[model samples]
Target chain A: MLSHQLMAGLGLSILWINALLIAGAALRELAALRARRARLAGPLLRGRVEQGLGPDRAFATHTVEQVGRAADVRSGIAIHFSDRAYRSTIHGGTLALADGSRHTVPPSDDARSEVWIAPTEADAPPGDAALERAWSEAKQSRGFARSLDRSIREQATIAVALPREEGEATWVFDERFARDWLARREGLAALFIVLELAALAGATAVCFVGGSFESVVTKVGGALCVAWFLGVQPIGVALSEACRPLHRAPVRGAWRRP
Target chain B: MSAGTATHNAESRIFKHPAEMRQFGLVLTYLALLFAMVFVPATRTLPCLALACALSFLNTVVIHNHLHQGMFRSHSLNLAWRCVLSFGALYPASANIPSHNLVHHHFEDEGQPDWAAPERVGFKWHLLNLLHFPNVAGPHTFNGVTRWAALYGREDFRRQYTREMVFAFGLTGALLLVDFWATLFFVLIPQLYGARCILRINLIQHDGCDTTSDYNHSRNFVGRLFNWVMCNNGYHTIHHNRAGLHWSDLAKEHEREVLPRIDPSLDEPSMALYLLRTFVLRFTRPVARAVALAEQRASVPASDLASRAERRQSIEAELRAAP
Candidate 1:
């Protein structure tokens, strides 16, 4: 036979568990957001590379050629850069450059190549522009690039030349970014873990006290409210994370400028 | 960007994908059914338990589609929707991310790595495989998720997964507080059945199929009505090929790319008929044998498959040439 006391105890235990779970999720999100903000604030290259013409076409062409060469040996390389898309087959590789050059690279393992574009060239303002104007343009470009298609946003890697002689940085828009971002925020993450654990303890104590109350409705209502508040936020984070791309593009070149 | 356009955009933004609107409708229907089961006196009978089980199974399918292509633009709203959906379905979206999206998609039909690998059981005993799959696969799925979280240092995923576990168990406990028998009948039994059904569908999808071939790796059920109810999931080959394609676009992709390249045996007209043939009737017919045999025959080197006359001539020449 089930007793009312037993039921109340079970409800209280659940309420405490739900609260702990929610608190942990909230803390993780807080840490993730902080890390993301820090990453964005730092001087990192972020923008879509427009198709270069005439003399300004070296980087895109070189990258496409290298990508084509790599795709010959390997399968599943679908790259969309500038104005054209290039899908590689085992038989041959087709590279469509932004400068309206379409060429095929023969399939060979020996043909593997890499192309590295200097951050200064990729991000530098064309012609003669004031430093302020270049900086403003760079900022706008970053914002615009964020709104690009998910495939481009996820697959593209930006070359960044850090200020104050900190040297060049490679910013990839994939899972590695998350790992690297989180690695830099170890202190905040530790604090969040401790706070979550404390919240769990506090919730357990509150639930235990509430279970002893005379009114069953009051106990049940309080548990439901706690569950609702705790459950909703973390579940949202999980959904967002699920929608994230699972695949990362193969990185070829990493040559950085001095 | 006009006032009318802005309003329309805002309204449209409620669901990110067109398929999400259908998902939203399914979720609403599940909620209605759940409320009826819980609150309506007429629905409190034993048969209502069966109804709950069916509804829960549908919820799992809906959640599976949501896990692949999220319902909303905002991450928070999608997560919230997942949590609400989980209450009905009893399968956590957090677990689904690592298990279904990452591991299963990555290492599909690859035996140990693929938690839902139908080939784990002996070829002669597919029914046993279907019956025992959830038991064998459930641990692997959870273990895979844990291993992935640890390997990638995905603390956020770990925390969210923990939260889902807590929420599921806590909600069950809370429900038990109201009525023990009702919770047992409606929630626990339905949850168990839903979980089994989820695993069963995966087994049915990939069972006895070639995992190596690009086009014919998975069997596709082409029933229009089933695809509609299952969010075009019947177009399995296309889904596997273009995992990122929206569920609404799967039929079009299937027709365009997969239909020509894929072997005829790989495409089934109805899942119900396939299941009946494969499991219920225990049909011994081999649909993929001809394709598999052809693939095997093609894989052999031309030198190995040379005619007897050529082999004899080569042997005689070799013997004469030998000192």
Candidate 2:
């Protein structure tokens, strides 16, 4: 009877270890997901680098079309910096046209009027010595390109370059806003890692704490569990990419500044 | 679409043409074989479990690689392998091949433009599971709701969702006739395990995602032990970087980095605690921050796809440029 109990306990331990193996698989899977996210850490739209020191030297715009949206604004145009980009309604800003005439339009009353924004600077292009160093450093960071891409694609176009001295007479949109956002996200990434690990641990603990065939099955059944947890998107992506090759976009390398 | 455009599109896209007859035949064979395997009496649960896990994982990896067109350039051959592996793996076939392969692939992490997300990011958001919620997020209702509505919808719902649900129902019916525990061990547990695995990884992949930047959204981890089990899935950045590269060649394509050893202590947190913490702290806060950051930096000049025509054009252009 004692031997039977011992045998049962040993079997359960093996089962629990198997569950941990599953959990470890989940952790391993996470590595791929992290990779996929890294792939998307930059601008999806391919645009040439507009050479310039600041907005005065280089900025271009495109007219917005008023079709199929809830927003009411009519006049919309895009702006470009070296790597950053934005689209804005021609509202309340001086449009220094190629013809040299400055036109100031009032902000639109339309609900759909979005002031598209990018990170193009007016005084110095990102390639300049001071900006170049910052770019290089930022590139080395895990998520610098992703931050820049988000800022470039979604936010309202800022007038100033990043890492500016406070005294500099530049109408700089706050680039740190995105960095702060990414910082919070980095914390989330860490949390996700922790959560995945815990799930594995929990499953293992449950098997150890509970001595039942169900526990054993759960543990043994869930081995390679960790990999499942981490690689869902890649699996989905692999599925999607495989099943529907027509839909995939070229995954761009995120611009790491360093 | 011009002749040049059609040719370019054909070259760039995964499903350049329709699936061939041999491929369909192979898929059918795989499906028949998988279902037949379930009905087979288990000689021993542990051995079968081991065998099934190994086989299923291998099939999943193979199918995945085939789907990416990373395996072969010949469309017919790619389709043949996809059918064989997916069916052999016992995954619901019709849904993933078409919906995932056709639609989601077409969209590729599109936020507002995706037909999947009618509202984009608004107050009504909750990543829905077949337009409803699952029990997994009971502890973190809102985040669970959002995660389900947002991520799940993107991950599984849109692809083989309807078909999978039906297939699961069919599986349940079939299991009723077979030994309940046998069904549990062989079918239910493995699939459930796989599902959980998918969700966890999916969340992490796009969770702290930067919507604007393409680079930071995904990063490759350099590890050999993990890669061996997952079939070079560790090189995901490179896989995405060159989706056409075969699974066998994935490791060779990317420059590897040194990764830290796995810490056993790190795996100590409970699921409930981890889920709750992620929901309360990670999900809402970091996403908000990323959005805010994008908005702040967006003040610079850039392009916006306001019209469907433009969006399609841009999408097509982006597809053309994709490696």
Candidate 3:
């Protein structure tokens, strides 16, 4: 049997190893965030519209409709729009327009489809300012900052100059962008998992050295930490993202044909 | 959806869901039991350890639910609730927000990127997976929380987290100072077990499933009693689909949105039965054969599953068709 002194030393060593791993993981994530910010440093919204031209170029004020169709519609469309984008859904079936008029329309069938809505009553787009702030803040911040940055980008309405040849180019916000963003975030997550593995290895090594498999605190703590890192953390992350409030900015100035 | 209008309509409401109150009650119950274990001499027996284990399990479940849907609309009240719950959890109340809520949820099981990806190590060796997970993922969870706190200007969150840390560690230190063995068996051991059980449930929920698939991505244990005790966590598909949904509303949502679209194999009537069959009885040829057969049946073509868009359409159609 391992002596108490030896056991204590091993346990302390394990804790120190874990502490180091945590520090290393945090630094790696910070580095990755820095790289990502640098990569996304250009214009908030860039790229010419390829096809799908419409003749209407004037900005019109239209009321949002269909507030109580289904949970999907309510959450996907109604709640997705930022406060600046549309009126409140408290009235259930009727949505108040930017013009103070209410309109009742069919339920939202597609989140991706363009619905006739008024531009937010802002003199200028906040894209550059929001992007600048997010970029600067991301350099110093960690954890959910990446997600917050993504959300900020998602919510910014930037007007892009369209080519004369291209009829209409709606700013490309699609599944591919979402998937790519998720993939990058996942890469950062991988670093954390590696750190966890290191901590576990330390604990396991100490357990073997101590020769006290029956130590309840050691056994249970090690097991709990391992189980939590492996599965529970992911589930929690997934659930939180699902429940996170949608704050999409209104899409304005798609550069339609006159 | 102007910020002012959305805030007025969505944020102004003080009470959103009924489950908040239920969760508060559970927290109170856990606190009472923890105090009893600490103070009452009669409650310090071996049997008390079992009771503590059970309470810790309930505490972790409540904490998990609370993390998803905060117990109170008031941030202060929620913070206080977290502090109180931390004693039972043996970790800070804010422990999961960044790691679990932000990172794990966003990534799911996308192999290496998913911090809690069970598939990182082979799922076939369940023992090894469980044994190694904390060491693997714990640091990430910690780092994620710390980074999030720094990045988001959540100074209050950081303070509370630190406070909870001091409270937990300080109390443990004090207990150890007073009586090491008692603290070990009564408090630390049970808390650890509770933590373990919490993680164990996740493995049971997501192991051996397509993380990307909408309906079949997660395996659900439909055991009524199990769900009732655990805040309906067994309905994982519904939980994943609508993460922000209150625990009380999961079953109804599952019936309406998930039931028709999800594969039947995804739902297991009893978690106990599944555990026994998969983990305990796998050595027996019959049980192994049955497990293999079930896995095969559950493996439906990806195309056969309805896209999220299709599901949304169906839900909209159902709602429109409804009176």
CAPRI level of candidate 3: incorrect
What tens-digit string does per-residue lDDT give for candidate 3 at A3-40? 33443454445345444443443444445445433433
lDDT of 2 by residue, A1-258 (tens): 113234345443534444344333334334534543342343222222223222333222222221111111123211111212223222233334334444332333223222223324322224456444444443231112221211122223333221133432112222344334334434444455465456656654554445553544544534434234334323322322222111112222222222
TM-score of chain B of each: 0.81, 0.46, 0.77
- Distance from true location, Cα of A49 in model 3, Å: 43
Which 10 residues in a row give candidate 1 chain B its minimum summed lDDT? B299-308
lDDT of 1 at B275: 82
Task: Rate residue B312 of model 1 by lDDT.
Answer: 34
lDDT of 3 by residue, B168-242 (tens): 778766865565535554677667668767766666666666665556667788878888877898888887667
* Model 1 lDDT, residue B24, Cα: 77
True contacts reproduced, candidate 1: 0.00
Candidate 1 docking band: incorrect
After the best TM-score superposition of candidate 3, give how far the Cα of residue A213 lies from its true spot, in angstroms: 18
lDDT for each residue of candidate 2 in B1-323, tens digit (9 for 90 to 100): 78988855665464333232223343344344335446765332454454555455444544554454434456455534444453344443323332223323333322222222222212122232211111121112222222222221133333333444455556554663564434444554444334334323334333444323422333344456656555666565445334445555666655421112112211212334444555444424233234223323433344331433343444334333431
lDDT (10s digit) by residue, model 1, range B153-247: 24556666666667777777787676543464456656667766887777887766776555656789998888888778789877765666788
Top candidate, metric TM-score: 3
lDDT of 3 at A141: 16
